[model samples]
Target chain A: MNALPAHVDIREVGPRDGFQNEPETISTAAKIDLINRLARTGLRRIEVASFVRPDVIPQLSDGVEVLQGIDVPDDVSLMVLVPNSKGLDNALRIRETFSEVAIFVSASETHNKRNVNRTIAESMADNEIIAKRIVAEDLRCAAVIATSYGCPFEGTVPLRHTLDIAEQFAAAGAVEIGFGDTTGMANPAYVGEFFTAALERLPGVEVTAHFHNTRGQGLANAYAALQVGCTSFESSFGELGGCPVPAGSTGNIASEDLISMFHEMGVATGVDLDAVIDAARAAQTVLGRKLTSHSIIAGPIDWSPTADAPSCR
Target chain B: MNALPAHVDIREVGPRDGFQNEPETISTAAKIDLINRLARTGLRRIEVASFVRPDVIPQLSDGVEVLQGIDVPDDVSLMVLVPNSKGLDNALRIRETFSEVAIFVSASETHNKRNVNRTIAESMADNEIIAKRIVAEDLRCAAVIATSYGCPFEGTVPLRHTLDIAEQFAAAGAVEIGFGDTTGMANPAYVGEFFTAALERLPGVEVTAHFHNTRGQGLANAYAALQVGCTSFESSFGELGGCPVPAGSTGNIASEDLISMFHEMGVATGVDLDAVIDAARAAQTVLGRKLTSHSIIAGPIDWSPTADAPSCR
Candidate 1:
């Protein structure tokens, strides 16, 4: 087995990616409260909201309110997802609210067209401009390539297609690039190969692994990413966030579960596991339903001598 | 990343390990039906019953009936769990029904005592006798070491303790040794190190990984075991089989979920993915509740060109 990195960074995306996919409208107050709670859980980065059109993702229509209402420490960097030029413009209006902006495009043409009603070339063109403008504004610009592993419509996506987009993002001055397994089609071996090539291709840019637990390979894929020395990650609290377009593609790897695995493996994440679990429980309460996070249900492993005796089989 | 094995063997333990843990009494007919279905799913080994006292695990009391009722092909091997000399005697009454018998002890003294009302030495003494007896009768004998990773009561069980137990099982004529994460306390890094050493120490005996998904690290731990060239695994269908004594120690790694990861990683398990999934769905229906296996919920990734287009984020 390969040696995993000593430390890793995790960015909580549940507030934005998770809430936007929900059918029920999360109140602006609830969203703000959750984001505020997450910020204090030792997470240095949290995606607070998405600046997409209000009519498109009504669940996240209160992005402005969520951004304005969240309070965090100086060390915490707030990020908001920007869909296009218009979304970037809206986010810029509340420039003081967040420290970073993320722009996304699908690696597959069919997914790109369905997501943003544009060809891959068109989305890339728009995102290049958006990335440059965000950098010019002196804010951190991050690029996310969705369906980087495989596309629901396209099946297996060529590896070069994703790397090409990342290269463009790096050329456009994006500080970080996130490769997303949008439909959880990624396997560990493929993840290992992808990150090995990605790290070599993008010298100074941060490569983030964003995986979904749709097929239950989320943590396994993340482990592969760590094995290849890619340290940055993006996850949702309580396994929130699913591609609403796909029927079974639900669940970003739960933040607590990911943290639990990292901590147990002796990798430092600098996040409070119990605190994040509490925040997930809070999200569960607000949603009025059980969430899919295992840590939220199991809690962290109790290592104390007085821990309960397990039933022997 | 380390190279994983090209081919692996999986033993379905849902009927014995999973059903015994359930609170509700699954009918004998349901168990037989499920076992028969699993036998046809390309799984060569199936643990169909346990010879523990009926009062202790009334759910699996009809062990004899199930073994007699299940119809399997020539290649299918039936296994039974035996607790002590008494349990082995009972299993021997219908010895022809199963080809294999498994005896177990915990690496931690507290867990072993709580589980079987015996110290580690006593259980080992009894199991040594049982293993020799089984082999002498022209049957295969396997050994399972519970709390092989960490003990809920003692916490951080020494790796040497588990390896020593495996050594004993090997000396006593056991053909295989299974390291069980009885409380879901195993992590990937530790798993890698443990399996690496186990394979070196036990050259001829098969090393198996039996993980619980209590902390959502089941698949990740299994991945580590694979990286170290440990090829055999024991998993329950529908993520069944949990420690009944420990709160929140529920869910063995689901067979379908583990198989899904393996198939996606290009590892062949010989089991039909869809057939195992159908069996898991059947378990869910019989149990009258949704099971925790992710593959059962998502199904295997549909690779057909006519597969449904996923929703765009």
Candidate 2:
């Protein structure tokens, strides 16, 4: 097997992606508190909130308020998701407050159209304009290709199709591109080959691999991507954010879970695992529910045989 | 990364290990029914029961009855776990009934003493004698070195200790050796390196990788083992068995989850995914509780977009 990367960048997406799909509406104060706690956990990049239509995602309607509330560490790059010109305008109004803004379009037309009520072409056009504006505003712009691995509506997205969209995003001057397995449909072999091809094709652009634990292959897929040299990852705290349509689909691979795996493998993710677990615990409290994160449930494997048993209650 | 193996041998251990850890005792008939269903799922080797003391693991107290009750297929090899000479004697009473009997010792002395109330040296001696007796009876003998990666009691076992046990097992005429992460403390890098070294040292022995999902790296570790060419795996149906001492530790990597991963990677395991799911579903029915198996919950990612939505409920 190939050697694993020495270090990986873990992009926290819980505040936005996770809360957006939560059944209960988390208060803006709770969201800000979680984001601030996450920032303290050595997470350098955090997708704090999404500036989508309030009616569509009422959970994140307080995006601007959340952005205004949190005290982001100077070293942390706070990112927010923007859907169109309106969202971008909202983000640009406070462009100096955040470090990065991301725009997304699903890899398959069906999913893109369904998600954003816009065709992939129209979304890309909007992204092109948004990407330029964000870059011009001195913020790092990221174009996330959602459902890049496989589409819920269109299974097994062709590699070429995703690459074509990525090429467009790259040309649009997006500095980073994230490929999201929006519905957790990616397998290890596919992840390995896809990331290998993606990095090879999109040289110099920061390539991030995003996976969900829906089928429980999230960490496995992350390992595959790591083996193929994709160093950036996006995960949610407490394993929040499943596919809305597929009601019970699991959330993004738990940020703490992914960090635990990397930390155990001696891969430096910069994110503090203990702190991440604390954040996850706080999230469970805030969400008023138990979380799916393995680390939060099981704790990091106590490597000290002489230590007291982990209280697994 | 190296190419995954073309085929893998999945040894089903749910009947023995899984039941032993369950809170309630499964009826003999129910156990037999599940075993029969699992046999139909293309699993060649199934550990049907363990001949441990009934009081110690009341859930699997029906070992003898289960062994006599189930219908054995012509192609399937029924295996059972035997802890000592007494357990081996009990298994030997039905010697013709099983194809294989396994003895186990923990890699770490603390864990070994804690788990079996015996030192590693004593367990090894006992295994050597039991292995000879089993081989004398023309039955395959397997030595399981538990906590080969890290022990809950004596964390991070040395590679030499596990290798020594494996060598002793091979020297004792045992044909297969399984390295178990009893506490789910193994990471992928360690798994790859350990298995790679194991296969090298024990050149002709069938090396098996067993993992628990306690910290959720089970499938990832399996992937690592596969990368290093260990093609045999031991897993539980419905993710049934966990470290009994560690109150909330999860069961062995769910058999269905591991099978799903291998199948998705195009590595054939001969196990029928649908049949395995059916068996898992049936297990949940018999257990009267929700299972931890990922594929059981989410179903396999349907590759055909036109397929009907999975009834996740």
Candidate DockQ scores, in order: 0.62, 0.50
After superposition, candidate 1 runs with Cα above 4 Å error: A244-249, A307-312, B244-249
Task: For each candidate, give its TM-score against the true structure.
Answer: 0.98, 0.97
lDDT of 1 at B82: 92
Give the per-residue lDDT digits (tens) of candidate 1, residues A166-214. Answer: 9999999898999998888899989999999999999999999999888
Q: How do the residues B88-206 of candidate 1 rate in per-residue lDDT, one tens digit apiece? A: 89999998899999999999999888889899999999889989999999999999999999988898898887899999999999989999988889988899999999999999999
* Fnat per candidate: 0.63, 0.53
User: Which pairs, if any, clash in model 1?
Assistant: A245-B311, A246-B311
Give per-residue lDDT, candidate 2, residue A45.
Answer: 92
Model 1's CAPRI class is medium
- Residue B112's lDDT within candidate 2 is 75
Best by DockQ: 1
All candidates' lDDT scores? Answer: 0.89, 0.86
**Which lDDT tens digits does candidate 2 get at residues B128-155?**
9899999999999888988889777677
Candidate 2 ranges beyond 4 A from true positions: A307-313, B307-313
